[model samples]
Target: MNPARRTTITSAAVLAVTGGLLTTTAAPASAATTCTSPVFKRQFFANTTFSGTPKKTDCDTTIDQNWGTSAPTSGLPSNNFGVRWSVTRDFGSGGPFSLAVSGLDGIRVYVDGVRKIDLWKNTSTTVSKTVNVTIPSGSHALRVDYVNWTGSAKVKFAYTPRTSATVDTVKPLVPTGTSVSYDAATGKAKLTWSKNKEMDLAGYRVYRRLKGTSFGSTPLTTTTGTSYTDTPPPTGETYYYEIRAYDKADNVSGGTADQGVTTVDRTGPAAPTGLSAHGDLDGMVLGWDAVSGAVGYEVFEKDAATGSYTLLKSLTGTSYLHYVGHNETLHTYVVRSLDALGNPGPYSAPVTSDGIDRTAPPAPFDLAVSTDSGDVRVNWKTPEEHTRDELDNYGRFTVYRSVGSTLGADAERLDCDYSTTLDSANDVYSFGCVDPTWAYATTYTYAVTFTDWQGNESAPSETVTVTTADGLPPAPVTGLTATPRADGVLLRWNASTDADIDHYWAARGVRQADGSFKATDPCTRSTTDPLTALCIGIPDGETAAYAVYAVDKWGNASEWTIVDATELTITPGEPIGADSGALWGGGGWTMPGQGGNVQWHCEGAVCADVTEYRVSRWNTETQTYDLLGTVAPKDGVYYQSYTDATMPLGSISYYRVVGVLSDGTETVAAHPWQIRPDLV
Candidate 1:
């Protein structure tokens, strides 16, 4: 005997049919059990006939059971009990099926109350039968009944669809109640539908397509569940979805009505192309080809060749004018398009601009003016960068001059142009020009401006005012006197009384035999200091005279103011002893330097009186003696020496020697000596 087959039972109301009046009830056990499709609700009765309320009820997945001479349950006698199993479900496009049963007692199988398999006899041995039948499509019910009279009680039954592809050619029904929803944030389209009713259904196939396009031959995805979530392109375009059912036999049904969803507008417009830029007098002009689907445009600009770009402007037009003020600077730019929702597109290729510089170089600074001999000289400085690169915009200077206190537009533009020199030491450009047209004893105003090659002029520099010098020389210097000293003759005088005195000139020379001075040269003194002067290294035993004059800024000069009534003899030192015995060597003396070399020898006690020796070189051009040096005597040395390396080659020169005693008495040579380096 086979074992009883039991299955899990769910709770549901039980309906009873009596005299065509349906009534709902439950057995005395506890509650009625419900079963899903393909599982059967089973009932048991105490008598062989199926009547009255069932003694027991439960769910059964299979209809095979056996009870060997024992009660089928707690209350039913196994020999006289009967059992029934029934269920209703969809078969889709219904097809051929087989119903089989085996029993030791009586058994029958019916489809919708029509018997397909029967073994109705209380046999001591098991009896079996099978029947083939065709069922129409849609919902239908099947039932099996068995009864046991005595001895062993057993029953088995089964019904199955003929699933051979060649025999079952019907496809599943179309999936119904199809619908879809969209989640904009996730860019996903969710599709849902009522579960298909086909018992042979394998799964559902979801299809998608763009609007105005047909669905593809292949499905987007296949799902065993009734719902699917699909990700669309999210390009702000409308898309459609459809649901279809496929069977285990590889048969697919027609698709349901298409459902549509419009995705979020996440895409922006295309990048702007054909961008261009050019320079105008006042700014840079830019243009580009129009972009499709673009509602506006964005312009970005950067000042230098390298750096991040920043937004310059946004507008609906395809062209723009970027105004750059007062500088010749290179500007780089890029452009992009924007949709109605303000989504930015790819940037166009970058462009650099050639812009005009309306700005002039900075005004010349630190302007100064001076007047001499009715000539006005102007000097100024400018930033060093102005002389390099684009900062060097101006080609020349425009000198403006006025006759009165203040300069105005009516002032004259000097006819001449001026250039500048870079004063690298000061890190500035130095500019100077002369205006020689002013009259003496008059006040004038001066200003300067830089002008570019295009004639654009910068703002004027600070103006300078100057009063011309009076056309008169200053009075002669007063209280002039000359005093002899060990180094030279000291000349002193009072300063010039004239406020515009430019400088004082002092000249001295040896007095000639005819009571006239010979070849007077300007003395060594501070030309800027008008009160005092020094005449250095005067040859001993020579008579000299000194004179001074005061010169005005207008180049006028006062009469010579002779020192000591114009005949002051300068005797700087006494004559050396006649027996000093100083004599120079003939040739090949290794002098201390090149060009001119001289060495002298002295003997006798007369040399003991010499504290130092003075060496002098004659200048034929100036008719004066240039002091070479002063040397202290070396004790016990045989000779004294000197070298004039600075003397030019191939020249004949006369040099003199003088001695100073230990008592501070200056001594002169009775006779001078001659040297011809060219001969040596």
Candidate 2:
């Protein structure tokens, strides 16, 4: 018998085609070989009947291959043979699908053993048919059978999900078996889940949110794989995640259970704002708006425009007071908030201010007391006369007189019967006042001070004591002469005849519109130099008279001997000097200390030429370096200090220093110093 003729007899008995349907009496064949689910288990039969799969068996991932007029595998007949492909798989959330089959002789398809596509007939040309079907969810079986009876043989079959939005509306199944792992060191969260079984599944979406917040509409990521790695904000917050599956048709499944993670807090609180500074007699007062999550605030201070901001203080309140003692130097300030975890936020805007004036001038010194009949004269040296430093903001002199032996706070403040004299011979500026209400034989104590325009008074000068005498006063000064010199009127007289004469008192006064003589201030000269006396700082162009009297060792006084002087003018000369710049380490701190500090070295010629250095702080709002104060150069001091105890903290600050010559010439620095306290 011929090889093809043998199959023709068996095919005729086992199969028949009528009305585009296949009728098969062939028994189902069971294979000993196995294939993984979702992969087609293929079996070849020698006869058209698929009974007893002894010819060949294998696995195929898909059924779209074309076996053209030849055996699909070795030892299989090219004609008069049959091939069967079967698979059982999960069609999760199953939906509409397309079944396509084409073949020359015959082809058929069955879903779960129910026939769906039938084009079974021996033909010379290839026959094609496509059918739509719905597959239920869960495990189900599919089978494709092809038979070649005679002529050229070829077979092709395909099964695909219908993914068009108008055609398939079914969603993918929710992912399951979700788990997560976290790496604290790298701050990474990795999530994994079982892949969805839907053939139309597009991908999975991962969502994350803070623990207390709801998940956002947008997904964090979308991936086709079963695992994903994410990086959440490392602000030491608790966060949650959810997984969802979506289909190619844009249908999405419900989200899985929320997964949670706690991350390490590496973020700081927000910076405080609305920072403000105010000057008061107490100190520099700083305040700012409180931050939402802050537990405390740190105040930093520096000299305005001149040094690095130092940590002034840390407190839980929104306000702070920077105690700077008796100095009213302008300072710059910044503030930062701290979280409970001690993380610090950015600094606030810089603020500059010079605190209210609370500083007083040095006290007057060299107090002397003398007495005349019916009056007592008090004399003291001005602070400028002793120190010769610039008497800044000098207002006037205050003389206190006490009737008791000891001077105390209750001492009487005398009226403005004051006078200032520059004695050229003695090179001293003296102030004197005569308590004309005095009585004879009375003891008195006197003290004086220099006061600023603000009425801030210096410490009292050393006290002077004297007692009026009971006996008669010395004879009046004889041969009284008044000479007008450049500085003041020079008075000359013969020595007093009384041996007990202690000192002579001279009073100068401007004649008022009334003819009565009004004493300005009484000057005192001891008996050791009673012949001559000089009155200093008597203004020019004034008709003035001088009266001289004698005081005994017991404070007795003689009657006045008057001498009038001609008008004279004393003119001041023009100041002169050259610019001597204040040089330093680029305006930065030369040494470590409290608050912000700026140091400069100016010795030799430059130090000798410049009178003082002015320090300033940068003011952002004003766009200028506001002056803090002046620093004078010492004769032998090479390094000068510009320290700002109230520097801005948690911010970058700028500082500058300029030198001033005696003639009012200014020398500026090459560049302003930049200090980043936050970075440090």
Candidate 3:
């Protein structure tokens, strides 16, 4: 028999053995004695059987005599088994309990004649059956049956009970209540909620969903705090909040009733109204109505046409001043509100305003000059009214003059009040005056304008030109040249002078090969005195030129003086062969005109006079020219003896000389002269 085979015997068989079967009552006294076995059964079994006639098998070999037949029986027959009958019984309360039976090839159990478990077939060596049963907290009758055929007959049974108290039943707690309120000043919604309740309550989780949005269930917090505050809800947006309680035990409560709140975004600092912009000579002044609930306001201003708004000022008050340093016909203004939280409100509607003070005094648009007795007579119509409105009674026109770069400190106020009403509905005024302080040969710039009662002045009319007393000075002579010094050109020239000459201006223009000059603006000049000025260290190049001019105080400039520039070069005249008295009765000769300087010092017979040669010499030992003299300038084309006479007979000699120009510019003799004594 295999030791692995499992067989369980129930104690009911022992009870049956100890007390004779209550059903049959026909067993021997010894059979009625209690059988001492290692098996412990939890329940009773009776009338059980084995599949074969009672015989020795691995599982039933040790069975109690009461359960197995004492001798082998012919054809297997069913047998009955029982326990002492007791109809009054109960199992404990609150139980998930079960009863099981095993051992005989087949077996069954009953309590008070009601079948509880059935394993009646004899298919396997050991089989067991179990059933869930609930007893009423008392005792009850139990019965079983057994049979034997080809195998041993054995019986076993057990029972276990369970309770409901061990199961978990706790639930999450809900938020108690919610409160909503409004901030009248800010137009914002504020919300607060009550704390959750639970012994293991780890914290309350808050969730918010905007109106029309699916609720976001993600818990916001796990803290135990009960109060929460939500402020400044999104503008024009309604929000809802729900809170749930979570226990440390991982249990969660359903969400509380949602609190709905809406925020009004319309409440903002009022638009800046009643805007007034006043203009003066220096700038503009802007004023507007104060907006309610505005911690501060920002003013954005821009030119009326195609200009982007620029932040003019952020003022806690309602008034701002702008310096219209320059004339501006129209301007646009916008304002926005800023809150204490640093949040900015939407921009206010833009306000377009025409600059105030439209009255402009008539002034000369064109100025003309007449000369008499060395004085300049400046005449002009009163500045024409450039604007539509009439000049204020206090309005007056003034004229200013400047000579050759010299501006007059004082201006003459003209009584140009001769008013003429034109068909165009414009008031015209004219005036003329003579300036004895003007100088001859000088140019002058004149400006005219009107002044208002508030000291606000209109922009000066377009600048007008006038020549003071004739006999103008000649234009400044330019294109001066100087000796070359150390790779640079030194330039010096006489500064042009005019009777009214305010200053002399000097400029340099680099000349390109195409005869075009890159004119540079006045490089440097003395305005106070124009008699002397010098430019030094001009770069060395061809066709370069300089322009000098005299400038009048009025910005009139004299004609420019121009001249061509020059460049320097070095050259070696010609090359001569060594005087060896061989090939040409003395030495061979050749001239490499187009070739430039040689790369290496020439050796042997291939030497020549080189005027700045190309560096293309080859090494002879390497099967190339030891030193190829590509270019050789003639040393006078006829003065060859001086260069050739220095060569040694039957030996190669290399020759190189330093060539210098009259200007001290120097370069190496073109190509080194290489002389082969044999060639000579």
All candidates: CA RMSD (Å): 51.1, 44.7, 43.0
Per-residue alpha-carbon lDDT of candidate 3 for residues 1-680, written as tens digits (9 for 90 to 100): 11212222222224324521112122321232221222212212223422222222122212233235422221213344222211223321212456766675555667667877776575446776678775443345554454544345555565544323343234444666676676535555555666442323467777778888867657544456766665645476778777776655555667788788776555555566777666643356666777666778888986666767889898788777675644556777877777655557777667665556544333446555555545555554542333323344455556666554444566444333333334333344445566645665667777766566555565666666666555545566654554333222334557555455556656567766876546663332322234333232222234457656666554556776655455332112223232222111122212111111112232223333223333222232343323222234343243222223222222223343333333554343333433221110
lDDT of each: 0.71, 0.71, 0.48
The residue-by-residue lDDT of candidate 2 on 337-419, one tens digit each, is: 88766878888888877677556656888898876543577888863332333243347777888887889779988885867
Q: What is the lDDT of residue 100 in candidate 1?
A: 85
* Model 3 CA deviation exceeding 4 Å by range: 1-264, 271-447, 450-481, 484-489, 493-569, 574-680
By descending TM-score, how would the candidates be arranged?
1, 2, 3
lDDT measured at residue 324 in model 1 versus the true structure, 0 to 100: 80
Name the candidate, 1 or 3, with the larger lDDT value.
Answer: 1
Each prediction's total of clashing residue pairs, residues at least 3 apart in sequence or on different chains, is: 1, 17, 75
lDDT of 3: 0.48
Give stretches of model 2 more than 4 Å off: 1-31, 65-75, 266-680
Residue-level lDDT for 653 in candidate 1: 41
For model 1, how does the per-residue alpha-carbon lDDT over 312-409 read when each residue is reduced to its tens digit? 89999998878785365677889999876677899998888657644455688899998755667888877774354323543677789998889976
For model 2, what is the C-alpha lDDT against the true structure?
A: 0.71
In model 3, what is the error at residue 567, expressed in angstroms? 9.2
